[model samples]
Target chain A: MLRALRNHHGEPSVRRPLFSPVNLAKAIGALTVAILAGVLLSGGTFAYMNSTVALPSATIKAGSAALTTTGTPLVLTGLYPGQTQSAAFTINNTGIVPLVLNVSGVAAPAADANSLSAALTIRVDVTTAAAGCSILPGTAGWQGTFAATLPTANAPVSLNSTLAAGATATLCLSASLPPSAPSTVQGGTTKSFSVTIGGVQS
Target chain B: MTRSRILSSARSRIGVAVGLVAFLVLVGSGTAQATWTTLSSAQPATASATTASVLLSDISALNTTYNYTGTTSPLVIAPATLQNTGGAPLTYTLTETNTNATLAAKIAVWIWLQVSGSCGTTTVGTAGTLAAIPALPAGATSGTAGQSTVVCIATQLTGTILASSGSTLTANFTLTGKVGANWQGTDPSSITQSVFQAADVTNITCSTSGHGSNTTATVSWSLPAGATGASIYVGSTLVLPDTSTVSFTATKANVGSATSITIKANYASGVQSAGVVQALDSANGSGCG
Candidate 1:
């Protein structure tokens, strides 16, 4: 019996682990609480954004600008030396964008070879007046001769430098032959004298 | 177990719990750093204006003098030019109004416009002929700067332009139109061109021919259609009166053969012309045959 008892002590004995139902439940609960804390912290920002999030698309298109002009004929009959004639024209911007204007005039040489072209002078002015252009504004936006000295951007007679689209501007052309003209210029005729107004994108 | 050992075990468990909490805090910090972003892009808006413009250039001087006789024809009178300086093509209509009644009643004005790229000098309905004015494509100018078109006034006498030789004729030719291509907001305009003419006689010719084996000779004359108050004579006998053709019996000699015939023409304006005399045999008419 003593030998048997000694042998039993020598053999390994299987004891119940610390896995009781109460202990297991407690461990599972602790694990669940920790996992819940982590998930809740990560979800806080996501939930706030989900309530107020939005995604939208938009589009933009281009615009256009155009210009046109109209007016009655400018004619001077029996024009004698030292005489002046005045006429008017209308300028309209038929575009979508505003524009800057450049105005100029060109005159042909006298049809008579012996006549003097320099003795004849032409004046062009931009105004807000009505037909006949009898009364030009004192502070005319642009005033110049029919020579190469046209009005440029630097000294532009602003017929509306920022002329809005579909807007109108009126101008007057005044032509004259200086009284100092020589007698030899009699019976001289000039044809195809023209005035032009060009527009530039501002 | 001994109290000290139990105390050490308790300290290890508390440390484990603290470690778990610390790990959770670190994981939460990492998760908090994640984020979502919405990107946006945009373009600048812009627009450009349409271009419309027109221009006319000066005309050249007229010929100093014109002759209706030899070498010269009653076709072209004075010269001028037109051009398109705007951004759009233009149509031009050219019309004439005579300011002087004497000149207007004597002649009718016409327009002769040169074709683009080619200068036409002939009259209408002929090769190298100029296109009539007031034509659509005929008077259309390119929408280009410095583009030029040539024009001239031509004439037709109502009765006779030759009668007014050495006299001056005055008239006005006006060109009017606007941009033809996509025209908008632009007004048509008119430009006046003045013309003057001094006239002269050019050529005079006469031919004689027999009429159908008869003893008659016919004289056909080539003069300006407008010539008037002129007289023709055959051997001192009045015959043709400013007519294109006239016939007269040949004078017969004793031999039965016709004698030569002498023809002369005189204008009321003191101008005179002579034709060669013609003789004919018995079978044929005078020397004209």
Candidate 2:
């Protein structure tokens, strides 16, 4: 087009600069079209013909772990040497996940004049029987003096079984004083202690 | 320079966007792997032990000197108070050890509970004989703690005195308290005295047999002299009504889980001898047996 313009003007018209505003605009437009065409061709080559069926939205929820006890905080009174007192309680898995149970003992200061807590022994037994601790069917999980079995809170005795969600287990706790208990224990009163039940995700 | 600055800003923005995406990814993964734990509420357990004790007051009245003559029949000594000082109720057994065996055989010492009456009064009920005249005699109970029961001691001549002048009798009474199911140590309260003589002593002896897992036991006893009837007791309950028959069948349930069996000899003079206790075999488990 520039040559035709020069010929129409008869003599060689003054040559315009190669980067004039109009020329620059025309060059930029051409480059933009070329880049756009290249991008479309590449996208077409990589793309495959496909269809999507929306699946039911995937749903996810977290399971909870919890535990509860029935007839807790057993209080025993009028304990004497050569005597055994037993209490029955239930442990229920109150959450959605299975849980493992554990027990620990915390002995209070010896309130009795004779320190009867030292001579007291504790026994824990677990059973599936409906008659409860009266039918102590299984072997004892723990059997020893209170000082030995529950020396501290960190020391926990395992129930040795997993409880499924909503399942319940019956436990029997027996406290006894051997006949050989010291004579000083006679007339002693108010020796106290506590037992705790704990649970964790299995 | 302006174009170079534009390129630098674009690169910086891309780096920031990349970092933000990485942080979100990491956070998402951490939340998925977390563990869940739950514990039970604090459940408390408690226990306690009990003790037993006893106390005797006004014990000085028991020690006395008794002067006797040929015509002296029986002497009633001063009355003393037996108190249950311990926390629990207690039953007691009194055993008399006499230095003079001859005088002990001829003399009968009777300890009775004085109820609103003086010593030697016929209204007072006889608890039991202290001497070995009746084998295995059961003593009176002191009841609950802080309860007091007035006790009277009387010495009677069972037969005619052979030696008139120099005969002396010294009796030591040892009261032992049975606390709960077992006996604590002995509380020795002595009644030292010099006595004359007595007539033939009446004795009652009882034995229990055929007691085991079954509820029935065969109780047999030797009738005391001049006794027209006898009454048997397993505890406070009377199993056999007053009768002349020396041997009879009684229910072991009356004894419950207790092992003590006592029998009383009823005399025509309206006097009843102390209870003679016999221990039931351990084979008789507990309860009805």
Candidate 3:
């Protein structure tokens, strides 16, 4: 239907459609610009209000599995076949957590002549008594030749008991040469070995 | 949309996804980082071995000279001292060589260790021969270096031996040292004495009664006219050393089933009567024979 509208000249004129392509494009462009402007203003407001106050620094320190030993650097002299020599040492768990203990042997150098590491039998036990290692109190926790027990470095065998935090355990060690030990072990043969006591957090 | 724009949008989406995945991985790893650790300490040890050797002192005095014409039975020889002179410990054994088989069969010897007191409770071997002597430990842990053991020797005859007057009987004693392997040095000694006819003790008897796991043997004997002392043995252990007591009671513990008790009389002429043996049973707890 034709519609009439009044112009400035007071003449009757025809009205145009509201959704014409040109008018629609102009509207769309204006909306797009407004949306972009809103996004920028919102980002600027957030940046202005974002104040960081380092919430009183919290310190977190890791727990340690510290271990200490005594009666080391032991020297057993004048050993003979069919004879047993004993020694006692202590392992202390000087940390804040409980620990599981382990024992291992460190072999002597290959250059040692007639090394007794392979021929000597070693036994380790936990003891509460004051007696020598010859009559150790508890059952043996580990028993074998040094060479066989720790064929390589850091190889460990567990002890029979665990140590609580700040606890100390007495360990009795006995070294023996069997009566059947070969003649090579005689004639003042000497050998130097090592024992390693290790602990892991339980 | 333009092809370039479409490709750029796809690339942006991929970058966002990768960043999200990376953030999750970091959070996940943070949870597993709370693992326990191990710490260790070391101790050093050393050992040294040495050869074994022994030394015998008072060897010359170990020889015994007895005149049976005036001497009584169970001739006591001079004591010998054995010392461990090497770095290692040692054990000892004895061997004997007799000049006459007849006299050897009639003769009995007892060797024991006693540093300053009476003969040791344990003898080296059974009477009459030293061939069955076991390796005797000279000291606890065998004989350590510088350790000394005093040995006591005594000889007696088993039966009456008729020999011509002024005749001499001789026997050589050899003591050897041993460790895991036999040692090189040995100690030699000798016994020389006159032979004479010596009478044996008569009417020797043994009776037994059991109490719990122990059995007590009561022995009584009529000593010969010239008897000096007598010894009693419960199994291989000497319960009573030479004594003048005619009747004695010896007790043994843990006699599971049965055990033997032996008694011998000693005379003034280095002679001992034949040993009398009697078996004691654990079931005879309430009765005495």
Candidate 4:
């Protein structure tokens, strides 16, 4: 009797729902889709190689003594006024970018501060010369020299820089100082003003 | 009864198995293959005197070698690429100058950068000088980086520092060509020469009104730093750009003076008398000849 009672407790009587063909197919379809999902989720997650073409932005330095650089050199006294200096420098776009330059800076005399804005802006197409060399456009063969003039003397002197994307140039500046002054200070007081010298690839 | 029980148990197992499979399928279909499409052309792409043709856009699109960390995320934002449809390379060769100058002056070319849009009414945001860049100096070296960028800069621009920029003398410049859209609105804004280094002048305002009505139209030019000549133009109608603006007035004799009259005025790089013209009209829509 005890064994019978234990069996009765283990087994329960319940009616099953009718099996349908539609349900069977659906079950199979679901299982297949699940397998596909697992495979796809991992497959799509991938790392691809990328590329880029870089162009340099313009960058400038206020005070530089680079002699090989091509452009209007900074006038730090010891010369005549309105004089111009020119030489060449090397600008290679080692980077995947192009650099551009716009030259404009005034020669400020001791007595007067020249405005950079008033300075004539000329587009000097810079070319990357032989490795490690660059040439400023328009200055390639400028024979006529210019002199930097000082109205008073001993004025603060400086140079500005402007550059754009991978464009670069390297040349010397032909700068001039005030004419031999009359006031015994013919040597010039070293008057300086904020001036822009050249630009660089950033 | 035993057969029925067996059948029911089998069906239940199948149902559970199928349910799990369906879930898997749904998860399998994901976003990997659904790549985003690049636009045929990027709008709001600007061209300014400074950085006008910088390969910023082209470089940004290079996916072969470089990688991008675009300013905006792809999931939340879509970036429009600035394609140089002009077919020509980016040519930023425009010169800014103050042709006639009595004293020393500084000239700067300001450039604006944009993230993206349909080349619509975007503003010229930042500033940069189109200064001359020299080669690497002695003891100087260079590095090759910046090949990839994620930030989509749709436009570039040129600007001059004027009153708002706190320069004594200023010039007026319009964002022409691609910028005909309209500024103060989604239209692309102009990159102006906001500041000229000259210290003589202060307060230079455009008539605000772009042009005038028929007959004897007035194109006003004023300078606090004072000017000698300010050249004005109506198309190539005026051969040379106006002469001076501080003290002298640039007037056109034949006055169709129609508001539709397209006029453009400019002062070379270092001059303060910059944009001294009315707005652009269909008639004034002539490119620099």
lDDT of 2 by residue, B109-207 (tens): 566666556765442334233346332223445456567666676655543333422356566666555553443535555555553222222343334
Interface RMSD for all numbered candidates: 22.9, 11.5, 10.5, 20.9
TM match of model 4 to true structure: 0.16
Interface RMSD of 3: 10.5
Which should have the higher TM-score, number 1 or number 2? 2
Give lDDT: candidate 1, residue B29: 54
Candidate 3 — which residues are off by over 4 angstroms? Answer: A1-55, A78-83, A94-96, A109-115, A128-134, A137-139, A149-154, A183-189, B1-34, B50-53, B62-76, B82-92, B98-149, B155-172, B177-289
lDDT winner among the candidates?
A: 3
What value does DockQ give for candidate 4? Answer: 0.02
List the candidate numbers ranked by lDDT, top first.
3, 2, 1, 4
Q: Mind giving the per-residue lDDT tens digits that candidate 3 earns over B1-289?
A: 5546656665565555555555554554453545343555666677766666666554444344332432334455556667777776676666677576655554556666565565644445444433232333345224657787776665654433434322455666666666765333366776665554354556867776656645576767777676787777666677777888887665544333336666676766655655666566545441133
Give one digit per residue, the lDDT tens place, for model 1 in A1-202: 3232223558655433444445555765687577767666656555344455566875677555555656345654333344555667767777666667555323343344424344456555666645447775565445444444655423434445456667886767665555455544444455445555655666
Q: Residue-wise lDDT of candidate 4 within B1-289, one digit each (tens)?
A: 4657767876887877777676656665645642111111101110111111112222212111111122211111112222222211121212222221211033322232223423233323343222321221221121111121222222211233332223222222211111111101011211222223333323433322223322133344354433444444454465345454432222334423323222223334334432434433224321111
How much lDDT does each candidate structure score? 0.46, 0.58, 0.61, 0.30
Which numbered prediction scores highest in DockQ against the true structure? 3
- Per-residue lDDT, model 2, residue B242, is 83
Candidate with best TM-score: 3
Stretches of candidate 4 above 4 Å error? A1-78, A81-96, A104-168, A177-185, A193-202, B1-289
For candidate 3, give the lDDT of residue A14: 57
Clashes of 4: 150
